[model samples]
Target: MRNNKEVNAVQATKTADYCLAIIRGRYPSLAPAEQKAAFFILEHPESAAEMTSVQLAAAAGVSESTVVKCCQRLGFTGFSQLKLALVRELATSREGAFGEVEPGDDVPTICDKIFTATLQAVEDTAKVLDPCEVALAAEAIFKARRIFFFGVGSSAVVAQDAQLKFMRIGMTAHSYLDTHAQLTQAALLAPDDAAVVITYSGRTREATDVIELARECGA
Candidate 1:
């Protein structure tokens, strides 16, 4: 229940930049339809920012509700709010050069430009990532006696990645891919335990169910 009352122009820019970073990190975990919506947002952000849910859905080859749901998964209230955030980003961004590359420019030149742009984006993300957030998350990890991570499909891969990272650091962590196994593990967690549910779209029913189970089990 975070509010945007304290968000100014700079904070808005940071939020937009962080949104892009999250999209990059989480894209592989999204469904095919959801990924299509994500690409539409990134590839044509200006146009997508101005679009209504229906218009965005048509452009992304998805349902209007699906487009709206994607926005929600990204922590937006709805399409209008998400669109406003993107528009703010467009306002702060530098304009690209108008000229198209000639055929003689070579593939390497194009590759270099793309790589440089991505590097710049990563740098921008680094500027906005809150050190305090990571510290708090670390504290949460340290305080919890047992940790359960849940994901499905590609998100399952991310869950396993987190599990391995924690285990290597000499922490207690478990990742579950199957619903039944997830329930069993969740039931074993005590009140002092915690669960990290990783779902890019946040609409995966099986994963959500596991989260609910963990909550009920006092995790």
Candidate 2:
């Protein structure tokens, strides 16, 4: 069994810019009560981050334990840890601004919000993305015999985009959006294969299963 250190390290390295994306990607796979908490968080990341587990429970209309379990289901140890992560993301995320959109807002206001939020999101992400991490990842990709992109939902589109770009550059790349195909390819990978899982939340059960299977096959 993995130790707490391993589990925490794995969970701690999740994407900071796309918590809502993550929630959405894995939302369909979560328990019903957890889905309620996820819905509350997606629409109210700031409020949810500031709330206690009990308060979140009240807001999400579920039990406190359900909120806690939701956190666990999303790869967090508990509410406070997830809350802190959300707060960090919120400070650097454009979704916070977009989350405040009202149904009655004008089209001009909506367009402006989207444009500015997208620019801000890019700028914020650039500030935090490490060049060393990019270099290491690139080196690994270059050394691999083949590259596989594993994703679901919107992330699957991202995987396909990546595959297209890599193939254009004459690289051996493949993307599997279908869960069954992803599992099949993962089971068939060789020792020198490299797979990048592209889910924003990094908590999708199907994606995680593919990664594990690939790892077991020495990918």
| C-alpha lDDT of all candidate models, in order | 0.73, 0.79
Provide the TM-score for each candidate, comma-separated: 0.57, 0.62
lDDT of 1 by residue, 20-50 (tens): 5555555556767887787788767777877
* lDDT of each residue in 1-219, candidate 2, tens digit only: 457896555446663445555565566678888988888998788788888899989998999999888878777778887887788777875465434456998999888877876775575456545566678778889999999998999999999999999999999999976889988998999989898988766678898998899889887
Question: Can you tell me which runs of candidate 2 are displaced by over 4 Å?
Answer: 1-32, 35-52, 71-104, 116-133, 152-154, 176-181, 200-206
Q: What lDDT is obtained when candidate 2 is compared to the true structure?
A: 0.79
RMSD of each: 6.5, 5.4
Report the lDDT of model 2 for residue 116.
70
Those runs of model 1 whose alpha carbons end farther than 4 Å from true positions after fitting are: 1-41, 46-84, 95-133
Clashing pairs in 1: none
User: Judged by TM-score, which candidate is best?
Assistant: 2
